[model samples]
Target: MATSTASYTQNQSILDALSRCIAACEMCADACLHEENVKMMVPCIRLDRDCADICRLTAAFIARGSDHAKHVLKECIEICRKCADECGKHEHEHCQQCAAACRACVEACQQYAGQA
Candidate 1:
């Protein structure tokens, strides 16, 4: 269910990926909060929040065509990978969905970051 950003500039794909990752992370964090064993989900929740925040910053940098956007994208890919791995460890549907989105963002960012 990846969204198409073909009409946008090449870097726009990275923005689209970040947007998806942010939404997914937010949803996953909320879902983790509602889990019966909330204590067990602390790491996942923290990662999700961190990932979302980073993704937001990365997207803003990219949107503004800042020189530092490349560095941000590199950092973003790392956080996205960590968030995806953490979410993948959970059985919740939202976690699973978030993991997929994070992974997608990782790939997109990595691809664009290389060109940056």
Candidate 2:
């Protein structure tokens, strides 16, 4: 009964949010790796990588109008929120920025994820 032809890419705001989050996640991971206490940042770095990868995949699923787009978005929201929470624990500028981006992505994903 739902519109199965939806194209995620057509939603500029969501696409932009996802793209920004992906970039932020990558940057955060790199910054974490260069921190003096890199070992302590292992969890953040791992989450950042995971968030970025999932964001990218979610975007692709949406762009292709996949039947699984809603499911992908739901997963993306969970990871983005987790990543944001982890980054929020750090005081680094990169982590702060990453957290902001992750929050934005979560907000965007929430709009359509419930339809899954």
Q: List the residue pairs that clash in candidate 2.
A: none
Off by over 4 Å in 2: 1-10, 114-116
TM-score of each model, paired residue for residue: 0.91, 0.88
Q: What is the C-alpha lDDT of each candidate?
A: 0.91, 0.89
Question: Residue 92 of model 2: what lDDT?
Answer: 98
Question: Which parts of model 1 have CA positions greater than 4 angstroms off?
Answer: 1-8
Worst 10 residues of 1 by lDDT: 1-10
Residue 33 C-alpha lDDT in model 1: 97
Residue-level lDDT of model 2, residues 1-116, one tens digit each, is 13433543346567789999999999999999999999999999999999999999998887776888887888899999999999999999999999999999998888656543
Best by lDDT: 1
RMSD of each: 4.6, 3.3
